[model samples]
Every structure is written in structure tokens, then in C-alpha cells.
Target: MSTLEIKDLYASVETKEGRKQILKGANLTVRSGETHAIMGPNGSGKSTLAYTLAGHPKYFVDSGEALLDGEDLLKMTADERAKAGLFLAMQYPVEVPGVSMTNFLRTAKTEIDGKAPAIRTWTKELQDAMTNLRMDKKFASRSVNEGFSGGEKKRAEVLQLELLKPKFAVMDETDSGLDVDALRIVSDGVNRAKENTGLGIMLITHYTRILKYIKPDIVHVFAGGQFVKTGGPELADELEENGYDEYLPEGSKESALA
Candidate 1:
């Protein structure tokens, strides 16, 4: 099985004041077919870790190695990282106003696979995936995520995840803007991808709702830019009731509660 390993990762972001550190020696490993949930309070560096691994330009890795099957992900470009079998489902998926969803998905698939998918087979696959997600046929012709509702945008993200078939996915708050029915649809898509391809997942979120559907094998409490506690699914139940207060420092606990 493939493995994605994050070793002592430290990362930062640029702000008006200056470059501020966000990830201070974070580490985790996700193997194929395993789901790891990263739960944390706001500004605890959860998203920073996600973006850092995805090779987002805004976050810089200070000293660390994000190795995907022994290859250093920190050295690859964002697209390169994707080609290497990593995917990021952003909390806020951006719109591509002029790119048709059909074209974008096929083009990305070609690039990642180093060959074009047969037109007839690809078309059928695309149609089936969208149908499974309960997306309307018109979305295929629409510009990627443009004019779509929040739930639609999230479904579109999952559409890419299913089509692209990445080895590992860092899903950043995928359940954010979804209602119960929409949440189930999106969660089912994630579960399908995992079952079909043995896709590893690093699911980052603040609540336990999605965990009920996605069912993480391990739960990690991220605080102070590093993992402070690790447990099974029961940990999520505990966090849901207690919140991050117990996990935060004496000073940060007050702000987290507020």
C-alpha cells in the first residue's frame, strides 16, 4: 500500500505584520485505505498543514519532509503534487469562470495520467459519476463551480475527487456548507472513492457530524500547531461534547470557548 508521511513539518504564512509560523513540528502518516481526522480549534494550524502538503504557494515549509512513498512532496509544485497522487478538497472551492466542468475534468485527468482518456469511455464515466452524486446533467456544461450553490460546489469538488482518483486526499472542511441530505451525498462520494481506490484521507474539520458518515480510523486533536492527542472514533464523540477547551492551553482555552 502507498504511504504519505509528514515528518516534523513546520510551516508559515505571510501577513501584513510579517511571516508568521503556523505549523510548529507537525507530523502524521496516512496509508492507503485509512482515514485520519484532524480536529482542532480555529487558528490551530489545521488548514495550514493541509495547504502545506498540497504545495499551496501561500504557505512555506520551514523545515520538514512531506514524503509520499519516499518522494518529498515539499519540493514539488502544486500540480506536480497532484500528479504524484495527492489531492486537496478546499473548504472554499474556487470558481473557474470560463472552464467547463467537462473540459476541466478531462484535461486534469489527462495531465495526471500522462495520457488522454478515450472520449467515449471518459464521457460515460463522467456522466455516471455526476449521476451518482445526484448532480444534474447541466453541470457538465457549466463553467466549473461558477453560479453553483455551496452544496453544488462541494459536490463538484467530490466529482473531481472521484474522477481524478488520487492516492490520498486532504479534505479541508468538506462538510462546511452542506445540509443533511447534501452532507450524506458528499460523504457517500468520499466513501465510494475510498472503497473503489483504497484512497487515503486526511479529513480536517471542527465538528463530529461528518465523522459519523466518513468514519475515521484515527482521530487527532491538533493544538499549538501539533497533534496533542490521538484516539479512535470515540475521541470525536468526546471532542463533540467537551470541545477543544480541554485540549487548548490555559490562555487559549478562554478564547476557544468564546
Candidate 2:
């Protein structure tokens, strides 16, 4: 079974001063067919962890291990990690000015699968996914994310999820900058993608709005650059009721950063 195991991950960004550690000894294990939520404040290393796990070159894993189905992800290049079935949906999805969505998807599919999908079948699959995502078929011919609204960009990320169908994915703040309708549509897309692919999802967000739609099997609270508390769905409610202040001392949090 495809799974992700992150053990005591300590990561930092390279700087002139020294390694500015962001994630501190965070541990998480996600098995196949499960959804996990990671919630935290700004600069709490939520996105940092996701980027690092996806093998982003900017951040360095000072100490710890991130394994994908028993393969050492820390040792792989960015493309190697993607080919190994790891995916990341960023908070700020980029826009390509010229590449059509169809072209990009075809290239990614060919690379990931190492074989060309039959044109007839691939087109049908793409259209079907677009329809399910409430997207216009015209988008298939447009440049990737060039003029997409926040909602459209988020939806495009979900579209890739449906098409690529990676074994594991880490969605960084996917719920950010979305309206209620957009949130519901994107959440529905995620649910459908999971059902269709059985992809293990690690959803990162600060708000519980998305959780209302897709119930997570586990909810983890990240603070001070590490996961501080974990619980069921009710924990999200508790955090919503009372913020991270109650979970961490003001002084300890401030000192931890210094």
C-alpha cells in the first residue's frame, strides 16, 4: 500500500546567518485511503513542511526522514519525487502564460506513466474530470492558470489531482482565499478525486471551513514549528472555539522562534 511516513522532521532554509530551522521534530504517518488535516498559524512551518516533503530545493531537511512507501524521498530530486508518486498543491499556484492545459497535462501524464494515454480515452477522461469539477470545457484549451481567478486556480489544482492520481499529496492551504461557493466546489472536487483514486491526502489549512465538508480521520495542531496537539474532528471545533493561544504559552512560542 502507498503510504507516507514523516519521522522527526527538522527542516531549515539556507541563509547567510545559518540554517533557520522551521519545522521542528514533526512526526506524522498517513496510510492509504485516509485524509489528514494540518492546521497552524502563519510562519508555523505548515507550508514549509509540505514544500520540503515534496523535495523543494529551497528548504533543507537538517535532520529527519520523509519516506514514501518506504522509498527515501529526501534523497530524490524534485522530478524524481514527482515520478515516485508524490504531489503538492501550493497555496499560490503559478500561471503559465503560453502552455495550454491540454499540452501540460499530456506531458505530465506521459512522464508520470511512462506511456502515452490513448488520445480518445485521455480526452474523455479529461473532459469527465472537468465536468465533475464544474469547469468549462473551454478551459482545456486555455493557457494554464493565466487568467484564472483564485477559485479557478484552486480548481485547476484539483483537476491535476484527479488526472495525475498520485499515491500521496500534500495540499498547502488549499482553503485560503476562497469564497463559500468556491470552497464547496473545490472540496467536492477533492472528495471526488479521493473516491476515484483512493489517494492519501494531507490537507494543510488554518481554518476549519474545508473540514466541514471533508471530515478528516485525524486533525493535527501545529504550533511553534512543530505539531503540538492531535485529535479527532472535535479538536478542530475546539481550536475554532479557542485559538492556539491556549495551546502554547506566549513566552515559550516567542522564545522558540529566537
Candidate 3:
């Protein structure tokens, strides 16, 4: 079984004000086929952990380790991390102006697998995955996420997740900007991926609505950079009834970008 292990992680980012720390001693262990929900207030280090794990250059890992299976992930570059079966679904998916989704997905799969997939099989598989996500067939010819709506961009992210079949996925606020229907569709896609591939997921979100659709095996409450509490799905219900207020202090609700 595959496992993603985070150990005493400390990360920081550069700002106009200078360096500011985000993740501090955050640790969690996720094995394949498990869904872990990370819930916290705005300034908690959830997204930072997601980007840090994906080897984003802006987030510097000051100390500690993130391991995939048994390999060190922090030492790998972004592409290297992808090839090692680590995937990140950003809260805001970026637009690739020139590249069509077809070319990009094919190339990515080729790069990760070290060879191109069979054309006939890949084409059918892509069509099926898109259909399952309720995406238009014409989307294949368009540039990746170009001119797409918020929900569309998010569905595109899940489309990649379904096709790429990564060992571990860090989904950062995937529920953001999604409506009720879109949220359910995206959540279903994620659940399907987890069931089909035994993919371990780190679902980061500020609200618990997404949790209703994609039930979490473990719920972690993040505060002041690291997790302050960890529990079962019941924890999410508690947060939903109350709020992050009881868990976080008054001035601790700053934006996570700090």
C-alpha cells in the first residue's frame, strides 16, 4: 500500500514585508484508500501545506520531511513530484492559453508513464472520463481552463485527477466557487477516483459542505499553522454546528497568504 507521510513540516513564503512562516510542525499520515479532511480558518496553513507538498517554489520548506511511499518528496522538483505520484489540485486552477486539454493530458500521461498510452484506448478513456464529469465534448479542443467558469475549472481539475490516477492528491479548497450541483459532481468524481484507484486524499477546505458529499475518514482541525485537533467524521459535524471561533482566537483569522 502507498503512503504519504508528513513529518514536522515547517514552511515559509516571501512577501513584500519579507519572509513569513506558514506551516509549522504540521504532521499527518495518509495511506492509500483513505480520505483525510483538513478543516481550518482562513489563515491556517492548509493551502500552504498543499503547495509545499507539490514542491511549489514560492513556499520554502525550512525543515522536516514529506515522504511518498519511502522517497523524500521535499527534495524533488515539481515535475519530479508529479512523476513520483504526487498531485495537487489548486484552489484556483490556472489557464494554459495555447495548449489544448487533449494535448496537455496526453503529454502529462506520457511523461509520467515514460511512454504514450495506446491511442485508441486513451481516446475512449478520455471521452468516458469527460462524460462522467458532465463536461462538453468540445472542451477537449479548447485550451486548458481557458475562459472556463469557476465550477468548470474545478471540474477540469477533477478530470485530471481521474485521468492521472496519482497515488496521493492534495486538493486545496476544491469546494470554493462551486455551486451545489458543481460541488456534488466534483465530490462524486473525487470519491470515484478514491474508490477506483485507492488514492489517498488530503482535502483542504474552510467549510464542511464538501464533507457531506465526500465523507472523510479523518478530520483534522488546523490552527496557527499546524493541526490543533484530529478526530473522526463527527468532528466535522461539530465545526458545522458551531464555527472555527471556539477553536481559533480572535486575531488568528488573518488571510492565509500572509
By lDDT, the best candidate is 1
Q: Please, what are the lDDT tens digits per residue for candidate 1 over residues 131-210?
A: 99999999999999999999999999999999999999999999998999999999999999999999999999999999
How far in Å is the alpha carbon of 197 misplaced in model 2?
1.7
User: Candidate 1, clashing residue pairs?
Assistant: none
Candidate 3 residue 243 Cα shift, in angstroms, is 1.0
lDDT per residue as tens, model 2, 1-258: 788999999999888998799988999999878999998777788989999998888899889999998999999999889999998998999999899999999999999999989999999999998988899999999999999999899999999988998988899999888999889988998898788778899999888999998889999999877889999989988888887775566885687668
Cα lDDT for residue 21, candidate 2? 92
TM-scores for every candidate against the unseen true structure? 0.98, 0.94, 0.96
By TM-score, who's the top model here?
Answer: 1
lDDT of each: 0.95, 0.90, 0.93
- Sorted by lDDT (best first), the order is 1, 3, 2
Error of 1 at 219 (Å): 0.5
Give candidate 1's root-mean-square deviation (CA, Å). 1.0
* Tens-digit lDDT string for candidate 3 (1-258): 999999999999999998899998999999999999999878778888899999888999999999998999989999999999999999999999999999999999999999999999999999999999999999999999999999999999999999999999999999999999999999999999999999999999988899989999999999888989999999999988888876676555453224
lDDT of 2: 0.90
Instruction: List runs of model 3 lying over 4 Å from the truth.
Output: 253-258
